[model samples]
Target: MFCPHKNSYLQLVCAVNPRIINKAVDQAMQREHFDPHTELPPAQRLESMQPSLYAPHVDITRAQLGFGRIGLRLINRALHSHDNLVQLQALHSVLDQVQISENAMFLINLQLIYRIIDLMLDQDPIIKEKVCLILSRLATYYQGRRRIMSRPVIVENLMRLIMRDRKEIRYAASYTLKTLARDRCACKIIMQNEQVVEDLLKMVKSDHTGIVVLHLATLTNLAEWDLTRALKANAFQIMLTLFENKDPRIVSGAMNCMSQLCKHDVGKVLADDYDLTFVLRRFLKSSQIEVIISATGLMCYTTLTTRSKWRAKESCNELTKLLVNLCCTPNLPLLQIRCMQVLINLCDSPDIRHHMKVYWEKKVKTINVRTHEEWDGTSETSSYGLETAHNYRTMCIEKVETIKNDFGDNAQVVNVHSYLRRIREVKEHLLQAINWKSYKN
Candidate 1:
């Protein structure tokens, strides 16, 4: 029988009916009929009997009673309960079954959100961790995000959790913060907290790669909201140092953060730093595709500066080779595009342009000739080879065409073109002055 206090009734029944529980357990054991020679362990016997004893209370028809309503009731009771374990179980059950609509309703009921936020400060790490997870899930929806951001205390609590010594709590806090940071309102609130950036910087410096990556993601979103905070936190330097880490995830996280930071003035300064250039160059050779993509992207942004152009010219041979290899490969279209852009920037240096020209002439011509011959005449077995070669050549040509069009259409390339043109004009003016002096002498 269901009542307004159904959960409380169930709890009271379990507490007051020890004889009824024993009778149900005895019936379950008699039904199983265990052998007299074999004795079941007390723990196993209790576990086997638990379901039968609790079945009456646990079984509820969804048609007669809404599961969502029942789950909310349990959570509501658990919120005010003194037992931490019971509170955790109740919250976990509700979160596991609560739909988006139910979650929206929960947010509308401000007290529920307040209770969850209050639980975040609980002494038990498990309760705090679960609370963070619930908050993280709720933060995924816009309304839920707005609700969480509405309470400044929630953000303040999360910031403190991020700084805690416990790894699990830190991870949970970081994840929740990452989701929260995606919303502009929440991000603005987080950015206003001065300790947010400082705490993230500390996590980035941590030896644990997982913690560093989570914090990096949170910082990335925060940077999107306000880059000045990131710059003030020395995020550029932290990311540059993280670039050398052996973990691909750490490298990738650092590169992604650097990519976002590079859009700011401080990022431009960091990009032009000689040490940062050395790190980017080293990362270009990384075996991981993600590492290469992020590294090359950062390299492209760095080359936007005139000083970085000269610096890029010094690595012309290596970069040209890297570009050619990427361009020839069909799978990495985005990387190839970025590499081409970098090459276009390096073209301002005549020496680098000459090196690229020579390399392309030799390599492209040889590959084209071989592929053309293979396509023209092919045996049955050679047909497959011919097709492969044809596809390769086609991709290579398309890449070249794409690069050329990008050069024409790209605004960045237009800037590089103007810089080169200005240098040429200056050289011509000097040449004219020298010729005039010769005639006067």
Candidate 2:
């Protein structure tokens, strides 16, 4: 039994039976209904029903209910409310409903971005943290990122928050900054501020792995825009330090940042100062596929850089083993391709080529012996066993024949010599793909 004026009835309920209204609001805000598919509790359901009575006239209902303008008004009012509890509740309410597209659009349209940034200065750490969370959600979209970046003071405020002693505030600020850095213009704006880079470097040096991961991600995006700045800030060395961190997430983020840095000849820096070959070889054992992939990629770049060749050659045995294992491993196409590229680069050195040849020869022989044993045993057994043995033999024969084609008539040398030629051809094709000019020294 609801009144004709739904908003008025709700307001009347709030005034007359404030406890009942608060209880209903509390139930509605419970975490159980957080999922979209979950049904609300009966009281919350009743509150939701009050809005449906006027749903037939959608636009008129939205306007008359003031869901658009009033929600923002409430937030504004609560933001400036004298009571800290009221301020926290108001911000939390806006945050709770932010997942709804209409409410998010309303907040964005009302230009609450600036107001939320101002709220970041709230003396209460909880209020500051909540505001940062709101900003993080808002920065998830392109328009929000553009709007947030429009005001330079907002970026400065975020940087200040990043340096705050409170881990929660620093984390929220770092996350929001990471999201904002996704936009090219926003990334440029962030990188232009020298203190942002400095503050990020300081965080990287801090003992906190979680905060370090976020700052590393933000720096990764920033590095993508300007590798020189990243290098100047000693990002490469910092990432190298993170590589040794025990946390897999921090290690992965560092690897990703190193990979991006290597894209701009920062590999030269990695090659010169760090034992990248040893580092990458160690990473080959990582259980994480992403870490393995990133390591392989940086290994490829490090080996390709002129100064790193000596180090690459020194790790020829390890590199060759890594490549062979990746090649034989099933279901990892990306890792296989990247390993192959690095293998091709390493093949330029005679020592690496020799090591690879020995490695392949050993693999071929091992497979050949196994196939022969199976063939011998299958002849006196069932038809099924014979068929299996025949298939195995055929596969081995094809592999040997493929090697023979490249190495000519010498079967003993075929595996290694053929592999050398194949890798050279792959390198040539890769160079041609990128239209790289060859210089005669």
Candidate 3:
């Protein structure tokens, strides 16, 4: 039975029954009688998996031989005890077991989840701290996230606590919610609470860089679905302020959030009004790879207009060199692909095209042209291969020709736009060439 007042999915998700949900929640969390390792083969069809899909990942037979079962049972009992000390110790013990991941899996149940949610509002600061800690630990696991995200009370409380709680509690609560925010379904539930969205936007401006980073990470998730919520919250201005901070993490976080926010015409108008193109250009010089990637991603959208294009052309020398360097670097094919994309987008201006030609003639930068033929293991190839960057040089060369040959002296962007399609096609073909399935497996 569902709550009568809550008709929509958001209301349904955020609506909690306090003590328990219907029998469905109980049935979903029920433990299988047999060992999961023995019963369920590893899910080979990885692409078909849903966000909240729970796969039995442990060997219960081995777990029963060890103290894993007993430890979890004791923690569960202690958390339900009348004494506060017992509850505190049990919460701490949960934190320890959660590090092993599988042990944490044993501890998640409907009763304990709601009980912990209730305990989260305890008057004792220490108890509140422990409650947040336990929740944070539980939230790290897939099973824990599914349960916690299902109950939107945790999201509301975490946002409230982050604003009013002490440093440690705030951090703990932020960690839990940020972990849960990884689920898009959970993020939609969060968007339903306008106050929670506003609180996150407010928290992103916290003086504490660590707090700012965690909250910004959470905001990034919220931005993926409800960009308008953040846009109306004047998140763009807050992001610009955050970009002024010297901490690479803060700047990168702001840039990443802005990357999502700039998806719409409204966000783009804000960027043009705030001069975000100039803001991101400075970050291209950052030594941090994350900062560079985030800045470049923002650039992908921000540089779409004639004004931003002209602005970017002002620094086309540095842009060209950076794009060229990134494309030549093996093992960083993903970054290379992004670099190629930005480079192609930059070509919308003939001034930039002429500038690139003049700069290339003065200093022709090249890499191992055969980088496509072999994996150098130079740029973190363990997770990816150089396949995508195989034709990277060729793409750049064709781009050069597109710019120079399409409309030599008085080239129209209309023709160049048609020419740029081939570059994107190459990117698409090279993207498919990547053995992403093998890498993920």
Candidate 4:
């Protein structure tokens, strides 16, 4: 193809003739299905389709031979083409032949990515799939990840893709962002990007597998920017919801990210903003141990930070109870270490220290009685000399008095009694395990 310039008549030539290109593509397609992952012809048969790289020596247009401008033009033309297949082919060619330098980003040619993004509005499932792959590849590309992020238009495009009704596209975009956010600088760029947080927040309720993954990825990246503040801003609710997902990886990632985000100056603010005492109360009983552990660690850290910055309040006592309960659970040394660290940090406050110790003492007594009952083959009722067991035994008897004074008994008692029961059980289990070891000696 030739676009004539001046009297010099700049000649532009495509390496592959159109007819042969089609024929070769057809044969390649017949041999193997079209795979977007395959950048070029199959590696085994590269010898037959030895493609040459083209760098124009003479000015094809008005300006010098800048690789950036040429790449944009090629990418744009590929995006605008009415044929999806042709667009795919063009995208493949650009990704294959374009020489991206170190530290440079795909944003250098943002317009092309924008052009492809515009096509996302189309309803074709196949095209959307290809677009997902293209966006994903661009996001993960060494320099390309940064390049795509630099342009607001590209972020808008990605946000739109993420919000798409299709699950596959949503997952693809989420996965792409997750990969990109692995880079610390890239995460900061994403956090500062226009509407990234808002768009991500909206994805919180999405049922798609990819969107959930994407939400965690986006929050993970945002936390890296200023984890404490980012989470306090609104990620807490979404992260809490993600904690409900069955995928262990997502649960683990969300927990770890939430933990890091809560480690900053606003850590206490985040805990208070989310009213984590209530949230963790529920998460403590989560079926997934990883979720339980992470939730526990986050609570411990949040309480530790809040004690230092915020005014002393009953909230600290609630946090103490939560941590003491966590300490009563059995787990990896790392989790116990974190729980212990929380205990040490919280020790600075006499009230928290006392409250935690009281909770620990009660937990120990409960465990000791239960173990004797179990070993003696005596029922709990007879062993404890109680006619009836009541729920909410772990709840601070002082909690209701405080609430009654603060908000009158008219305030409906949030039935946190269940959480208390679970925590008591966890404490008993840990205590039993530890006591068994001492008796053996």
Candidate 5:
């Protein structure tokens, strides 16, 4: 007798016999049988069905009855299966269709996603690849991305794939990490994730550009989280070193991360201990606008934080010139803010102030270039006959400048500048945010 679990596992492989696979796929497509109001089936019975057969039915049951308790029970049972093939098949089936219900099966889906991930520790390379695919699928699902990293096993498995594998599984694992970081809890887990960091550093040193670049992107995304101190420091150092990679893509990814991290105190720490300036300067000359923009952003951060140290010792006029060039882009508001804020902080000196004044005038001119109709369009309309007070909410621009000065003589100027600039830029961007011009006319 053929095993249903084995057949389900085969469903994921194109190499499997088409007839047998199609037959199993057909069974999986059948209508589900379960009730939303009823409790799940006993564990043993649910475990008896193939994941391929049970996954669809569970999803269908949940959709029809607004519950998937039976499906969850079956998934839990499959999780306990001793056969690796059976477990892999179960993982494949569970991930095939999107889960739309918030019932108990949702819990089972989370549990099963972890269980498959647990298989990454298996000694078999094939099994490890299967686990990588499972995690990738989980991360790819819009719903699943939020919860995927909550289970430490998910990150653990992805790290394992990154560390021990050389195939596409490694890339998939990194992509999964990038996805998981979209969730705040997941980002914290990655920030404190020691083993993952060690594996990532090793991957960065590998000859494979794809693996290293994607991993760096994931790391940069992780920097968005409020990470613990020691882990944050370690990650900052590793990523700073990656800025030297010859591959422009790898350099860009590393620079993207540096641009963000350099906005934090830890960024100053890295520059003090590493050759952060040289790295940024070299990458700024990249042929790609994206690479140049990222490199310039990081330079803006470094210039803000390390300016005093550099100005006291060596001339930083070239850096300021490069920043001015970067600030000229009208479309790159974030970049312009970072570069402008850095320039403003550095402008306290008379010499730098003269240079910055020109850019400020440029910005002022751009700010006022609105069409009369566009300007009048947002003018508040008075509904009442009597004088109505229009509360025009205006930004306190001087208060921000004061705060920039308030950070004190030794304040992390780059971070301070970035903080103030980010707030204003966020508001500006939101105001200019797209309602899709097609609809907003």
Candidate 6:
């Protein structure tokens, strides 16, 4: 077996008393008749664990002990003690070990998962706050997430805690939920639980940016799966109202949620009614890159339809130029790509197409060397997909045309001339591949 005494992760736990640490672990190992990983059977199980109605497997073993199983076992026993100081020490020790996968499995084997969750109900707010933090840290791993999701009491407890007056604990509980909400299954659970949704929505007036961000982020995750509850909960207006908050974090979170909320027709209708395009347009100038990116995402929705495109234009005359500015920086690939997509959508409106061809290209075409978005017509199911399927013919035409236009052109040309040539080549191939002359003639 690996020596726990030498491993750095175990130093804090062993520091309490090296002898005690070894004794707990040695006693566990000496029980040769029992599997250290498995717990007592139904009738003989701890009353607390049996009530959970599920047999929790703790993966503690000699191999994983180096990850801090000894500390976890001691902490588990100490948490059940009536003494507050002992519980606090155990909780602090857990903070160090719970981050490890092996520690989480040991925690389950010790049947300590239920007790940690139960600790959330402790009358002392500090204990409850620490409990929420432990849960939060536990949730950052796959093993921890699996264990947490298995306990239904967690969601209810967190929801109730968010409603309480203790700000620190409320934020911690919401923080734990924010981590859980990132998982698809967790999103489903939150959406299905009407009380959870209601509780999150009621926290709309929270002054704490941390709690607000967590709640909004959690709701945003749920909205991505289904916009129904977001619609029913009035998420559109709630996000808009929260946008007025001075905190960029809060505004960005709301904008992200707004992006998902507007994916459905009903949500879009509400956005249009509220003149959201103007609001988004105003945020385009935000100093925070996060707010700008979120605004750009929401702006895409505004160009999804004929009416919305004009509305987007009305709110900001330099929509294409502003979008091009976002594309100027390749450092933010997502923002750059999203800005280009918004330009593509805006080009759906005939008048805006000229702005894209002239202003957009002049401003940022070099930033985007090649694109699949400028009408590839790759859809074969379009009823007439064969018109541009001849690749060899198009390539031959492209080379022939470039050679003809190259007339005195040399590799010595400046970067600008070369850049313009590339742009011209893209447009020429785009038209040639589609057999532009055949259709026009």
Model 5 ranges off by over 4 Å: 1-90, 99-110, 123-127, 137-154, 190-194, 221-237, 260-266, 269-279, 306-321, 358-441
Superposed model 3: Cα runs more than 4 Å off: 1-71, 361-441
Best by lDDT: 6
Which number leads on TM-score?
A: 6
lDDT of 6 at 286: 79
TM-score of 6: 0.68
User: What TM-scores do the predictions have?
Assistant: 0.65, 0.65, 0.67, 0.48, 0.56, 0.68
Clashes of each: 0, 0, 0, 5, 0, 1
Better of 2 and 4 by lDDT: 2
Q: What is the lDDT of candidate 5?
A: 0.55
Q: How accurate is candidate 3 locally (lDDT)?
A: 0.66
Where model 2 places Cα greater than 4 Å from the true spot, the runs are 1-69, 328-330, 350-441
Cα lDDT for residue 55, model 5?
Answer: 28
Q: Which ten residues in a row are the worst by lDDT in model 3? A: 53-62
RMSD of each: 13.9, 16.9, 20.1, 19.7, 16.3, 18.7
Task: Output candidate 6 Cα RMSD.
Answer: 18.7
Per-residue CA lDDT of model 4 for 15-133, tens digit only, reads: 44333554466676686564332333332333323322222342231222236556555555656777655565555554443444331244335555666566666665545655556
User: Model 3: per-residue lDDT, tens digit, 184-245?
Assistant: 77788777775987887777776477888888888888888888888898888888888889
What global local distance difference test value does model 1 have? Answer: 0.63
Relative to the true structure, candidate 5 reaches a TM of: 0.56
